[model samples]
Target chain A: MSGRSHAASRLVVAAPYLWLLLFFLAPFAIVLRMALSDADTALPPYAPHFEGFATLREFLGKLDLENFRLLADDALYWDSYLQSLRLAGLTTLIALAIGYPLAYAMAAAPRHWRPVLLVLVVLPFWTSFLIRVYAWIGILRPDGLLDIVLGGLGLTDEPLRLLNTEAAVLIGMVYSYLPFMVLPLYAMLEKLDRSLLEAAADLGATPVTAFLTVTLPLSLPGILAGAALVFIPSVGEFVIPDLLGGPDTVMIGKVLWNEFFSNRDWPLASAVAIVLLVVLVLPLALLQRARQGREAQP
Target chain B: MRKASPGSLRRAFQPWNDPAAKPLIEFRHVTKRFGGVTAVAEVSLSLYPREFFALLGPSGCGKTTLMRMLAGFETPDAGQILLGGTDITEMPPHLRPVNMMFQSYALFPHLSVADNIAYGLKRERLPRAEIAQRVAEMLALVKLDGLGKRRPDQLSGGQRQRVALARALAKRPKLLLLDEPMAALDRKLREATQFELMDLQSELGTTFMVVTHDQDEAMTMADRMAVMDHGRLVQIGPPDVIYEAPVNAYVASFVGDINVLEGHVVAVEGDLVRVETGITGMVELDEEAPALAIGASVLVGLRPEKLDLSHDEPPQPFNKVAGEIWDIGYLGDVTMVQVMVGGEGGWLVKVALTNRRRRAARPFAWEDKVWLSWDVEAGLVLKP
Candidate 1:
């Protein structure tokens, strides 16, 4: 009976991991395979052919150079990449500026009020994310709520243009990604050695000065984690830009999406996919490494 | 704050108070409460220039809260905290001239030992040369001159404590507060550091307020100590005074091992108050305290080493009690023998005997009938 139970326990422990391997790990391999393989038409041609590799090589050789040139020559591709970088940078900065204060306020709030503050910060997450973005459409449209309120106040003669701008896209990104920045930063700041701040204060730093020297530096790991979290996805995001940004706001995700669906150029899409991967992989890897470095500290 | 202790004297001299060598810090009836529970209640104390004081207590006894209030991390719900006679109850911790060495020795991990010590000086916006020179002096004072390059994680527990000390002292605050400075170190290390701390205090001559639950740590370092229990100050005096003459049962029990015999005052002799105990026989204590009427119940606290244990009853003009040896603890320097003298609450009659190689000298062991006695001058008379 005990032996049977032991085997059952082993199976129970192994089940979740097995499920993850089957669902998550297998899908990534499929994506890699899909990235490599050529498309003949309606569906992937499933005959055994090293044609995928041949196509991949040829694709890598001249056409790949053209993709590179596409990024370099026409300012659009390069411009989109630059805009993505710019948007991501702006979003990260804005998120950090807003989230740090909110996280700090949450962490330092009275014990009873803390959870409610946290919930309010995270309430956006519970709401339909898509609905929130759609709500922004209602607010950011020229005759939208924002412009209507401003016009009512007689701040401007015409309804102010808000939607389909870089600022609008950044606002949307920051709103969508706030909790990601806050939760980690809050967790870190909450567990901060208040004594370090006291020690700083005792040592002769004013409150704000102490925060800069002690509290801020100590929570850097959490800030980095939040920044990476917001940065990684924002650079690759298509939905926010497509919804909020106008013609000039073409991002890498949109280009890849256009190649795949609109132009039906799977090879070109794959090539663009490869370029996006190249651009993102190094930083993401470095971020993961940095996180691991913090943990590795004894 | 007319009714002030040594700590209150230091409080009056705090930088924000008098701005000169006026007492440093003064606690004027400062009380703190956590909802329904009061942590520090209507307590007033002071600290003076270069005085080393201690707030000694058991766990959850409001000492830490008092220290926090002084540091400006905690606010008093009633009354005000005066820094050098100036009201600073509302001042934030960073704005206070006081610095604290935290119990955990909270050192910054990312910065090197040098930078950690230099942090406060840097915050003051001192010139680079002055900061460097001060940091070097601090590193040497803590005896970690070459270790400036190492981060806190690289140093041992003692080294980390020294770094924390150096850092707290670097800002040249009028007061330095240490919360269990040696608590993290092992027993041997803690003892060594205690003396080093005394030396450091003497060398620097800065007023220090240390909070510790360890009685020995408090006694060894503090010039004057205020013992607390259940959010109240039980006694405030020099180490010898508090130990030898604790005001009540709690202070005596908290400070050292005491055999408290419950009794009632039966008679009064010249400089001696006689008490008849339920456990021990008639005992005599000093008549220094407020006079107690006959038949009034009291407790006589006797230190373990003060009592003499013998196989044959000793002939002396002192109190004597008879009991059976319950247990024998063989500590190398002093062997602790527990004698049961009782009815309801078993009396822990402790007697420390010198461990001699001579067989004849080893008098009593487990289960042997023994007589425990002490001089009239030994035990203290306190009310429970």
Candidate 2:
């Protein structure tokens, strides 16, 4: 407000600035150094290979029209990328349809009941990640609970093939990422002005129309955030596919995995990781910055 | 259930003398109760076409409840509500031929001013052209022309209030209800907007039912007012009638500034009932109330301006009291003089002394022995 107060606030901010430099900026610098250095057989924080940039260019160059040249055709990279995008997009959409109503119920329940709802949503998160995938595996297998139940009901004559399918992967993806989608959506929807709904009804919108025109539009931010949360995680998801997916249903995460662990091409895997990082993390970073922009508003 | 009262039907047959006499909306013996608590009890009142009516009461007195019921936001637990001689109590709020400007002015922050006003018209299924024209006209009426693209949050408080008013009026419903319309504004803005509301109501010729806790707001805005206490309607009349002729001590105390002196009834003779008090002489009721025998406790209320203060004792036969000036308060427009009558609690007496006539030395200083005096018509006796 005044010149002296401004100076005093600057002096106060200087302390946090020093802390951030020591804790956050230093760690980021370390990551930058590692990302730039070439991989070595020795310990990490390896020698500063100045040619790492040239190496990156060469590695990227090998991705063009030659030995691993199936990437140039429509069948290889496009098919995998398209398949990944479709799965991610559909998974996120399905998650929303299921998650929104669940989130709404969680938010609208009495304040005392919220913690119980939160715990129920988070119970899936508590189990070991691989065990959860294995649980889905147990259900989706041909002679497992799902086929057994269906066979008992006489819906299918025998144990219908259920495992290693796209549907199984989709089901697992939706189930696993649902809580991430719900939390932020619940946070946004819960804080919504109840008056707006009443106002809409008073202005002659039916309950259904009011939800579509008012409730849906105001919850856009939450929807977008949840979609990103589900999409980003699902794009790189390897566990669900590796466990329950069929032979033909390949995704980019499997590709990255095969290159790194199975094929033992660390440089190629790192390149794939970098590509996914650019595609997904860049937007996430921008969205986070936008959120900070809103927080900065007076 | 659809039967109109005998008196109401009889009055409905008479040729209306005033331009504002046609009944637009009527609450017929309506009572709303939430669980064990009655929010409004047997409230039968009518809002004539183009009349600015006010429901004034303290907090939790159900003035807002009555307004909400009229808007069809709250349903009466008993009795019927009528609009244009049609029983519309069962109608939903959206279907009713009325709109309400909420106390918070509930303007949609997401929508532009024009869109907010256009909402009801669009709901009514009017063509896009007609909706646009009406929105433009309504915006202009509220003096917010050429500002259609701006959202509600971008507007100032007064501007938002005007936008809300415009949005409510855009529907051109048979009646418009305002809930504490000026409560959100600053003092100066509130006073200014009160006149604007009055002028707008007159111009539009639409019946307005305003609910407020502030007495002065009701008095300044409404042609007629109903004073309520604890969900019970105390008195309903023109502003002046309700102010000058309150039915009880509560109404008298609540409607305006007054000094209510308690006394015992000495006699009753037709129109007048005389009561003797400790401070003043025999005091008379405003008009004839239900008769009570001798020695019934009563209160006589007097306005501050009516009570004349002097250093010398006035030779008044009745309604006279001796008081010492305990405190003097200087306001630019008027001064409040606190007088200690006997040994007990001192009474506040507002005196309208001219600034031009007062000398350098104050005429009435604290601790001065003075005599307070008034005529017979200066005060009323509250019985209830």
Candidate 3:
């Protein structure tokens, strides 16, 4: 019985690992191989397709870092990377600024009303994401709903030119990723021991001081998790920027798309994708390591 | 175990007896209600400086509510709370010069022990060297000297309790309120911590008001205690007085184990009263009798430890009854035997006998016919 149960547990553990190997690792290996090869005019658009094990050594020898080197040498790729990082960082900060108070209010609401608030946070997910992004266009375009409302309210004399701007892109991203930020924060703040706040007050810290010293520090794990959820996705976001941002708003995702489809530079696009993964994964891995080290302390 | 004799210390510092002594904290006609239920209703109390006071009651007895009002967590609806002659009824909790050791300890999980202790001091914006010195002193005071760098989760429960105590005390408030301070500790640790807390309170000379449900804990640590029931202060006195002379039936049973016998006053002789009980026949109490006509209904309260049990008939004639042993409970320190007197459908009276000798043979068994007796001073004549 024990041996059978052990085998069953092992199978349960292996399922996710197996899934990752087949779906993620296999595709990543193919991309890495394509990234190392040379661009060509052939149907596949990349040279040195795997010919068999007999020429394996030759295939390995043909692989090079030329695409990566070209990416580093060009200013457009560098600028796109920096702009992507900047936008993603700004999105995270704005989302946090909006999400923290929203989550805190929900957590402090009456117990029976909490479920309704949580449902409201997650309600937007029921709608199609693409449809929501399209809806933003109608609201943000000049002479659209926003401008009409502002003009009708006597707040503005002329139509607002907000569509296809970086501001529109920011508004779209913050609206889409808000739930991702709020849920974790709400979960953290809701379960916080209220006695700790009382203890703080008992110890002579005002409510604001208590929030800064006790609540904020304790909610850090939730903050980090929420930031990662918003940052990692917004860094490579293709839809919001493509739909709402102006031509001057150059992000790496748009650049990667242009390189792969318009220019048909398969190796360069693969290299760009690889470099983006490394940039995002490195910090995340470092953060996980630091968290684990702190948890392991006596 | 060296017992800290708070009894002697309390006798030497009985400020409540002195008419001229001013109370450090006072609550006057404080009334708090939640929705339809009155959690604390028209309650008034006082605590003198350096007095280790306890509010003892069962859950929902308003003991915690009273403490919370003093700690500035709850505002009284219609009353005044004065601290050192200043009315602080509407003062915010942070502005109040009172701190609380929470029932859950409420230690900050993210902070090191030293930082947790220094939190209130930092709020005062003390000098850096003074903060460190005070933190070190608190650490030593709680006997957590070398564990200052450890996080709260890393410490044991007892250690966490000490950290809470230290953190609350670091502010040196005029009054430190403890809400079931030792409720989280194990029984063994709880007993030891009670004495330690008493010692610490005396050494620091800070007035402490603890709220708890455990009678033993309150009796062991409190210089004086108040028993609360259903949002009202039922009785207030030292532990001995509360135990020996409870004003009513609820206070008597709530404080300790007492076998109540239904009886009536048969005669009143100057300072002595003779009562006739169904269970123990005629009993005489050698105490000042309350105003009573002959045959007025009364309750005779007999503490278990005050009664003696034996196989043979007791030498005394009055206040003795013959009964069959209904049950025997052998606790390590004492043997509690329930004697069913007055034959069938009669009252079962508990008699506690201390085991002074190791491995003493069982003197009483179940179904054994035994005689129970007590001195005249042992029976309390309580009005029914």
Candidate 4:
């Protein structure tokens, strides 16, 4: 009976590892191999395609760092990378500014109303993401719904030239990623022991001071989790930028899309993807290590 | 019950008896209601300076609510609360000169023990040097000197309780309130901590009000305790007075185990009253009998320790009942023998006998015929 239970536990532990190997690691290996090869004008686009063990050594020898070197040589790639990082960072900050109070209010609401509020937070997920992005266009374009509302309210004299701009792209990204930010924060704030706040007040702290010293410091884990969830995906976002940004908004996601689809430079696009993953994964790993170090203290 | 020595400091301290003495804290007819349910109802109480007071009650008995109102967590719906003779009913908690040790001990998980103690000092914007000195002093006071660097989660249950006490007392507030302070500690640790808390309160000279549901905790630590029931103060006195002279059956049963005999007053002889009971025949009580008229229903409360049991009849003929032993519970300190008095299927009266001798042959067993007797002064006449 013990042996059977041991086998069952092993299978439970292996499930996620097997999933990562089949889906994440396998695709990442393909992308890395393509990133090292040269772009060609032949079928499958990249040169030195694998033909099993017979030509494995020759294929390995043919791979080089030419695509990575090209990425360094071009100023457009550098600008796009910086722009994507900047946009993703700003999006994360704005989401936190908007999400924290929203989550705090939801957590502080009546207990019976909490489930309904949580449902409303994820209500947008019921609609297709592409359709939601499209809906933003109708609201943001010149003389669109937003313009009409402002005009009717006499807030703006002319039609707002908002569509196909960085602002529009930010609006789309923030709108799409808000639920990811709010959910974690709400979960953390709701689980906070209210007695701690009372203890703070009993120890001579005003309500605002208690919030700054106790509530803000305690909810940091939730903020970090939410920032990571929003920032990582926003960095590699393609749909929002393609639909809402103008030519000046040269994010890395759009640059990679152009290389893979329009320019047909799959090797360069693969390099771009790898660099983005490294930039994101490095900071996340460092954060996880710092958290672990803190938890290890006596 | 343990009595204080004749010439000891505790024996001389009785400010509540002095009518001219000023109280450190006062709750004047305070009432608090949560929705449709009243949590505290017109409850008035006072604690003198340097007094160790306790609010003892069962769950939902408004003891906690009364404490919360004093701490400014819950505002009273009516009436006023005065601290140091000044009204502070509308004051917020931070502005009040009061502190509380939470039932959960609610220590800041992210902060170290030293930091937690220094939190209130920092709020006062004291100098860095003074804050450090006071934090060290508080750590030493709680005997957690070497554990200042550890987080609250790293400490044991008893250690965590000390940290909470230190943090609450670090501010040196005019009043310190502790809510269910020892509810989380194990039995042995709780007993030790109770004495430690009493000593700390006396040494600090700070008025401490503790809210607890455990009668033993209140009796052991409190100089004066108020028993609460259903949002009202039922009775308030010293532990011995509350135990020996409970005003009603509820206060009697709540404080300790008691055998209540339903009876009616048959005769009144000044301070003495003779009552007839169906369970144990006629019983006599030496108490104030002016309010208890003849034929009025009353309850006779007798503590188990007050009654003596013997295989043969004792010299006293009054207040005696014959019965067979129904059950014997041999606790380490005392042997509780339940006797069926009068006849079969009659009232079961408990008689507690202290075990003075070590492992001697059992003198009493189940199904043994015994006579239980007590003096007239031992029974308390209580309102039914």
Tell me, by TM-score, which candidate is best: 4
Decoy 2 TM-score against native:
0.86
lDDT of each: 0.82, 0.80, 0.92, 0.93
lDDT of 3 by residue, B128-157 (tens): 999999999999999999999999988999
The true-versus-predicted C-alpha distance at residue B282 of model 2, in Å, is 3.4
Q: What tens digits encode model 4's per-residue C-alpha lDDT throughout A28-55?
A: 9999999999999999999988999999
Q: What would the per-residue lDDT of candidate 4 be over residues B159-209, giving only the tens digit for each residue?
A: 999999999999998899999999999999998888888878888889999
Interface RMSD of 3: 0.8
lDDT of 1 by residue, B91-172 (tens): 8877788889999887887788999998888877899999999999999998998999888988999999999999999988
lDDT of 3 at B189: 94
**Per-residue lDDT tens digits of candidate 2, residues A52-116?**
67586565443322213323353655576678889999999999999999999988899999999
Q: Model 1, A1-298: lDDT tens per residue? A: 6999999999999999999999977875554444554555655532123456658655444321343445457766777777788888899999999999999999998889988988888788778888899899999999999988888999978866879988889989999998889999999999998767767776777878878878888899899889988988888888898998888788888987997889776655665666677787888788779878866754
Which candidate leads in DockQ?
4
Q: What is the TM-score of chain A in candidate 1?
A: 0.81
Collision pairs in model 3: none
TM-score of chain B of 2: 0.90
Clashing pairs in 4: none
Give each candidate's fraction of reference contacts reproduced. Answer: 0.87, 0.38, 0.84, 0.87
What is candidate 2's CA lDDT for residue B321?
A: 72
lDDT digits (tens) for residues A16-45 of candidate 3 = 999999999999999999999999999899
